[model samples]
Target: MVLNKKGIIFSLLAIGLAGLFVLLFATGYQQRLDDQNDVIRARITSLDQGVDSFYDYAAEAQTIAGTAALDALYQEINQSGTFLTSDNFESNFTRCLNSSDGCENDLNLSVLLTNYSAIIATSLHADVQFSVNDVCLTQETFWDLVVRTNISISLTDTYAAWDTSRDITTTISTVGTYDPAYVAISASYGGAEDRRVFPTSIAPNSSRWNISTFMDFYKGRQYQASQNGSCLSDRYEGSWTSSFQGCNLESVVDADEHPRLKDPANQSITHMDWQVLTRDMHACHDPVTNPDDFRVSISDADDSLVLWNKDTIRYGLYPDHLDFSSPTYNAPGCP
Candidate 1:
């Protein structure tokens, strides 16, 4: 059969043109896909930034709120000269944090957070929500306390959404707050003019007793590391009701118990134990000439040692065992 060259040539040309059309279609489709992906990635990046910005605002609000509440509480304590119980402190802190009318010291955390959240929404043009769940105070150092605020945050943008919670904390130095013990001491013992003595008149269990406050003030002077396992040292009490004589070294705690008396961080010791340790001042020593007056006697063996003694005891006499002059002193006299 005679070959049709022109027809064959036309067939080849048509086949080539068809393949070329398919190649062009594939390249165009891939380029469009890349552009779409790029736009999505950009939107995701912007949304991520919005979430971060929201977090920053929430953290800052927590710090300011915590500090303000603490400062206000401090002022209240200063003006009243009354030691607020732990429960009272917590209640007041929450009241101050959420109060719309603001505290007497002029701080309103509720208003601060609301304004901050509004700013975030306006700037990012995104939906945002913030809720403060809790504010807690924990011991950081002997002289420092930490305030932690937990906040829940949710943010939604056109391309992304985020929901999370975090704890934002701030440290408050005791130096700034002034030693709470000193405040109690000055108020109870006739200001700085009188020797800060632990009045024997106030029963150890009395709510007005400042032993726990003094323990915190004493810092490193804890029971576990101090005495030889007993809460009171051996001493004669001639002035007692003719019945109580020698040191009644009460219940002896295990060597490992109450490793840290001032442990605000872990709180290893119970409140009851804390009370017992501070209240046993009368168990070991003779009440001074005046039953209302309790004198702290230092050991002659070691000037830093806290010994239970009668009114005739010698050196290292400061208010009880917790004194400013001695840092290494330990009082392990009561169970």
Candidate 2:
């Protein structure tokens, strides 16, 4: 009976020991699983931070680039009369092509570098693209002029109410008539001409008459008749007539009536007045008229760097899926 009791006690003790072992094993297994899960969460978090950092860097770069471009545009527009000659254009363009570090002095290279560096430092991969659009030269001109001349002539009766005389005075006067008429009835030989015989009458109802007048008597009728004659008559008339005849006087006196007569004969001679001419001329000479299109791509190979690995694994960093895109870059002379 005692032996049976000992066996029963031993069996109970064995069962208890087995239960403890099983409990310990399960607890250890659970702990290992928990540790693995924590590691994975931590890695994911680090990857997210790295990705954020990269994006921050890219944003900074884009801002710098945009500012630089704007500054360059302004400088080109407001530059002084040191006008961009063909040689200057070519030299500047060549420098840009050769990636000349000195070009920054003439342009806003500091801004570009800030942008480029920011992007390169933050991103696992990067590249640069530049381009230009259409360019054309424009020209314009401006001028001022003065003209001087003198002549003797019969003017239209613009102020008929103010004059009632056969003799027009030596004083200068302004008239606004389209036409006027006169008549002469003279009996004269070669004797000194008489002015009294000549009759200057403003027809009361004449549609074109503005004024009329009579002159003092003179010995020579020939001189009076000659005064009322046409411009050609003043040079060729040798004799005076006694018969009455009608005469018409017409003239044009405004020099400014024709406006376009003074303009530059051609565009090539007048381009300096236009503000855009300089820029267009430079672009034409430089041949930088169009911008080029480009694409930015990133692959897994770029993520192999230690920093990237640390971000991905230790820091749980991950990238925002690259926005694979074919983007366009435009500059001054691109089409």
Candidate 3:
């Protein structure tokens, strides 16, 4: 009995110790799992914040770009008359780099600078083209002095966009009545196969010539008169020969040339051939006339006129023609 009792005690002690060990181990394991959970939660929160920050930055960038583009457009229109021509457009755009109140907001100005620099560089290297249709004349001599005229201007531009080619176009029509008395005479004399005269008209008498000839004479006189203030000594000036004096002029002539020679018989219809005097004027910018942060460039190409990265301005006479005015006929010397 004594030996059996001693064996039982030893067995009981071993079992008790094993149970304690297992309990302690289980407690430690649970604590470790809790610590790991906390770490994971902290990491996830940090990741979320980083993603939010990235989106905010992108949104800000977009806003800056959009505002800068609009502001630059407004400035360009206001200054179009002074510096927005084809000749000085590049230089004018460079001047826009200066940040004034109009373009000085830190974010917007920075965006403007970045984009404009790229645009200017591209424009400088880009190819441009322009064309004009000669004025078509439907009427001949009206009152032997005035002529009607019509003209068209076309421009076009081609360039690369995203490594691909693109094109834009602009067209304009200008009609006005002009006095033949003020027209410019070509270098050649005696209607000597002058290429300037088109759809030639001949009169029955030597004194009264066709409207085309009269217009040529008027144009020559106008140019000369512009320089000297008078149409005297012009080649078109000549004595009225016999037989031509009796011809009746068109009614349009009486409306164009009144006062003494308002006879209805003295008027006749004449068409004026139009020619382009000037094309591809350069862009310009004068700090004295306009004070702004951004610069602009304008060009006419492929029958399209562009104000370089901006909307067209309506402030000046030429640009105004873009919005208003249709072509009409008057004596070349009426002005």
Candidate 4:
């Protein structure tokens, strides 16, 4: 009876040991699986953050590049009196964006993206590539100049077995950029072929009006006729010939050397300067005393008046024509 009881106790102890081993093995296996899942989740979160950062960086770059390009275009028009053309805009934009192209102010868009990709590659232990397919520019509103582009970004990580591509659009604003009216007036005179700049420089030019005399006759509040010492009527002096007669640079007496226009100047457009655009440059030579002989009155119904074509006007985009002189103003004896 004693030997049989000892055998039963030994058998029960062996079965208990086997159950404990199985329980320990199951717990260890579950813990290992949980640790692996946590690592994967952490990696996914890191990748998501990286992607978001990349998008933000790209957007900022595009905006800066677009702003630079737009600014350059306006400068070109301002300096050279050139008109904008849609067909040549992409090339011009690229030139402005690249520093190597001799652009006055270059953002170097390609180099910026390359450096950004390198930083991303180092952080994620992956390969990053950015490709620019096309650049499209649009003026959505008078204040908004939108830059849309086909930018493709590819990210690949071998360890995570992850690869992805994304497309993004970038925008820029010109709310307070170059004056729109200034550009319109400059372009209206002539494009690059026959560029003409207003507020003529303080130098001698037979064809264009000199700044000193222009201000004296048009903007001077104390303007007078040289012959009579009488105040000349404030009007657009569009009728003048090479003889320099009748209320012109040679005939008018300017009391103020640096004259201020009656109306406040905005974007450099003077009241008389803008009004001159409404009439033809009629050549008049009055040797005798005639106050109104060489004057082109804005109120004159006989004088041809031009109105801006609102139907074809656009903001920041190319307008083929604006209400300005066609065969631009020129003094007699000019080639």
List, in order, the clash count of every candidate structure: 3, 42, 63, 0
Which ranges of candidate 3 are over 4 A from the true structure?
A: 1-4, 69-105, 108-335
Instruction: Tell how far residue 333 is off in model 2, in angstroms.
Output: 36
Error of 1 at 142 (Å): 2.3
What's model 2's TM-score? 0.27
Q: With candidate 3 superimposed using the best TM-score fit, by how many Å does residue 153's alpha carbon deviate from the native?
A: 51
Q: Residue-wise lDDT of candidate 3 within 1-335, one digit each (tens)?
A: 99999889988988988898898899899999998888766644543433343234323443343333323422443233111333332222223322334443344423443444344335443322211112111111222211111212112223222221112121111112221221212111222111111122332222333333334433442111011111111112211111122211211111122221223332211111111111132234332343221112123322211211011121211222332132222212111
Residue-level lDDT tens digits of model 4 in 1-335: 89888988888888888898898999999999999999888887887787778778877888887777666665665565534553455567666764436455656667677888899889888778767766665543323455666666777775464444455566565434443223434344443122111222222222233233443434332222222211111111111121122322222211121122222332123322332322222223222333221232221222332111112111111112322323223322111
| lDDT of candidate 2 over 62-118, digit per residue (tens) | 333323332232233223212233223323432332232443333332344344445
Winner by lDDT between candidate 3 and candidate 2: 3
> What residue pairs are clashing in model 4?
none
Q: Least lDDT summed over 10 consecutive residues: which range in candidate 1?
A: 231-240
- Error in Å for residue 264 of model 3: 33
| Residue lDDT tens for model 1, 92-190 | 767776663435534456777777778877877778887878877554333344667777788787777878887777664433333232233234334
lDDT of 4 at 119: 95
* Positional deviation of residue 260's Cα in model 1 after best superposition, in angstroms: 33
Candidate 1 vs candidate 2: the TM-score winner is 1
